[model samples]
Target chain A: MAPAVLIEKLQKRYGKVEAVKDVSFQVEPGEIFGLLGPNGAGKTTTIRCICTLATPDAGKIEVSSINAIANPKAARQKLGYVAQEVALDKVLTGRELLQLQAALYHIPGKFAKERIDKMISSLGLQEYADQKTGTYSGGIRKRLDLAAGLLHKPDVLVLDEPTVGLDIESRVVMWDILRQLRDAGTTVLLTSHYLEEVDALASSVAIIDKGVVIAAGTPSELKDRVGGDRITLRIREFCPLEEAEKAKDMLKSFPFVQEAIINVAQGNSLNLVVTPQSDALITIQQALQAAGLPTFGIAQSRPSLDDVYLAATGRTLMDAELAAAGSRDPKAERKQNMK
Target chain B: MSSTVTPSKPNVSLKPEAMQVSPAPGFFGELVQETLALTRRLFIQLQRRPSTLIAGVIQPLIWLVLFGALFQNAPKGLFGDTVNYGQFLAAGVIVFTAFSGALNAGLPVMFDREFGFLNRLLVAPLASRYSIVFASAIFIITLSAIQTSAIIAASAFLGAGWPDPLGLGLISLILLLLVLGVTALSLGLAFALPGHIELIAVIFVTNLPLLFASTALAPLSFMPRWLQMIATLNPLSYAIEPIRYLYLNSDWALNSVVMQAPWGAVTLGGALLVLLVLDVVAFFIIQPLLRRTFA
Candidate 1:
């Protein structure tokens, strides 16, 4: 059987902005696939093309072996999309909104009622189901949007930033529910900028930057490809630049320490990538003490998804997010998203 | 954590290949189902928040009463023999109310577009996206009917005599034709325009101008020659003249002269035909636009 979802060489442009340029990925059945990237990295644009909400200027998109461009209705039947913005009508009760979703998907009347009831119960929305959605909390609204997307039990469920604004408790609940859906044989695809969210939930991830897929693999695999243990050492609460440089120079003499750089933004703390070894942390602490630079705090761990992103893009995801934020035009972005 | 638990139906896999494929339903059945589903949503919105409906009905009633009182003592027999200005204004108000209501039909659709709710609908497995347009037309036409009734009742209360049974039938026909045509145009604008702001701007500029240019407030003869020609050409006049003629004469025939245009005299039957043609033309005119977006 073909993969549940396949996108090859996907290209989309909004005027001069090449929102998605040459994106490609395949989602295996019953796996949680993640599109991980910073804001303005074309994650949402890629999701839009897959869900048939926006036509791609080029490339092929297929859902369950059906060409999205040629047979969009068929692809729509197989795919369910939950957008980043919860587009619920303020006047509609949660139940009414689900009913509308059921009808739009052409669910049989008998099955629709049962499915909507199951969704309301599963999402723990029974209490709020009768109230207008305008009165719902953010968490409850996202849950309702999720229930609406799942009402049809689509073959591939596509979500764009599903837990962007949820509280920790709700975010946990959403992750559990997504895992449950995957176990039940639904191919789940989601896009998010939260590295930990993807690290915890996604079985396989694609890290995209500026509309290109920089790295794609299982979280552990990608992290292992970076091939180092990260060590963060702060010489002082707010170390002087000279003190940070002294620590960096002292730490670099160790054969296990592959690279060390002072992160000026974090009070000149040293961020080190050391060759994996059992006692790398203790040796680094001893080296700092010998240099007469006190270690305020130090921690060591295997490379994380964030490290993989940093290794690939030469900047942390947070830094990329800040950079993208300053350059983004809210009006132009809203216009791009409007249609 | 009982990962070893086996299903009773071991062969019943959840994969797509295990699913049975059934033949899709016939075209008309699917169309009707989808259209009804969409129309039901609009009705539910109208029911839950009856403000728009209430305001729609009340506004036209106020126009009929206040406007009728404005010209209550106009020169007798000036409008026509035995036809008071109030009586003459009733048909115009009814047509104008429906026309205006139909003109604003695109607002909800435009809002849907702006809020990304339309994207939700577009991504669904709809049988035909035209059902979206059809649902809007049904809702707007129903709304115009309610507003038209309010105008009819208000006119009757203001001593504007009621149309005979046959006249009422003719009036309903004309209103439906005009509503269908205008609703199509409004929905077309909803899809053709970029956003709600642009759509509202167009409606704002077009509404009062179309009302003034038509025979809604005054007779064609009262206007300058150029304005009279424009009024005759306005589709609103085609709807208004027939109903106005019906109210004035109980024994009116289909071919009775209703409007004296600059070009020639248009009979009641000819006015009805124009509305019918307008409906057909408007539907075809928006076909390509709807297809480009919906297809």
Candidate 2:
């Protein structure tokens, strides 16, 4: 009856770094909820707090009506966490690792064996199940890690960056498994920086930036929030700032073109928001031709999650990723995650 | 597609599950199950990669053989009326081997922590987190037993006579007590320290110093006043002296005076009591560290 997971006003600080600050979201039962953010945006920290791996400085995290903070043991029993890093012991075989996981979640020996076998087969790890995980490829390791996380079939499954470093095939597999888990009545929560991963898989998304939730809605609802068709137009492949400004001003003059901004990080490209008009692209091309400006490239489509993010944060997700990457302290982050 | 049939619904409520899993076992039952499983994993690792075990036994045998021979030509009364140094050195070697092996018990756990393997264990619905520590203790104590056996076997072959059955059993008891204490500290260090490199540094600085200061290689009389004070205070000394006394005299009693520390003579019973106290103190000291980590 309570939401599968309710994290209200969550705050976590690691020494001087406020890893997660003032985050709130509710995940409905049997739904796949995505916490979408860039690196160092506190998604993992938030997951850690929810899964009871790290204590939140302040928050209410209830997993299936259990208070995760006040009663971590009971909450942990109801939650399965697949950490961002695949934390399998290299020496352990896939089956052995799952067995260990089953026991930790207190799956009785008889039931554990049955579940382990079924999970290994369902996860497509039968061939590698008995082999030491050290010999596994990245994809295989991720599969095993997923199986281990799901062995207990917790009511709420929490995953942190489930496919950050995985290959395309593996990523697709991971997504499929997540959907299957949801269809089978498991409430799934995942954090990721990949827009498409979230857009394609997550039923609803919470966009977080700098440890704050800037937006929360279904993927299409978020896409609809910006309320216009997106037009990304590049002049001369790399337009000059003045030319980009001129193009922005020209585009803004049209009644249909409600908003225009120059994307400085993308070679001074012009990003526009226009009311849905069938010939918006053609009209833009004609305007460029009449102005004697060469149109290097142009495309138009419905606003995506990136546009939603940009509208709310004043920058694209890629831009935020680059900025966050530059200022990140890997050493300190490692220490925080290790804790 | 079967998967794409369900579109993203912004306001749709998720229906509860039609079928739920059967409930888990009671707390203590689950705790025992998990602990045994974790301990079994450690043993399986040891079984597959027997290098640590092989090296553990071999290193002490080397010390017993080579180090015992190093002083084979010492004066007859040099090691206190023992016909040979091997006889006197057996207890020290056995206790020191157990101590050294126990000191490194935290390495596996430290590696687990460093590589994020410990995070896997931590996130589980473990009944008690201390089961992690308990599993490590069980593994390390088993290893100490194996290594102790190897050392004792090698010494007996080198003309260091074996103690009577009761003496042999007492030797095991003393080593078990010592191992429990040291293993607790090592596991505490595993959690308290940042990484394996620092843990190894602590172990490197600690291993030999504790041995040297504990009358492992030489008797208490061989040390200067300050060194004697340190060696007397060392817990390893308590274990080593009791076992050494048992080996020397077939007629040993629990109250037999084994060594005369700077303070006074400590009987065999007194030595065992000291080791027991050391075990208690070591565990007491590490409780807070474990709490901070497992919290």
lDDT of 1: 0.86
Model 1 stretches with alpha carbons more than 4 Å out: B1-23
Write the residue-wise lDDT of candidate 1 on B140-210 in tens digits: 98988887888788888888878899889889999999999999999998888888889989988988898
**Residue A36 error, candidate 2, Å:** 1.0
Tens-place lDDT digits, model 1, residues A4-57: 988899999999999999899889988999999999999999998888888999
The TM-score between candidate 2 and the true structure equals 0.94
Per prediction, fnat is 0.45, 0.49
Predicted candidate 2 versus true structure: per-residue lDDT over A8-53, tens digit per residue: 9999999898988889999999899999988989999999898888
Question: DockQ score of candidate 1?
Answer: 0.35
CA shift at A282, candidate 1, in angstroms?
1.0
**Per-chain TM-score, chain A, candidate 2:** 0.94
State each candidate's clash count.
Answer: 0, 0
| Highest-DockQ candidate | 2
Report the lDDT of model 1 for residue A124: 73
Give lDDT per model, in order: 0.86, 0.87
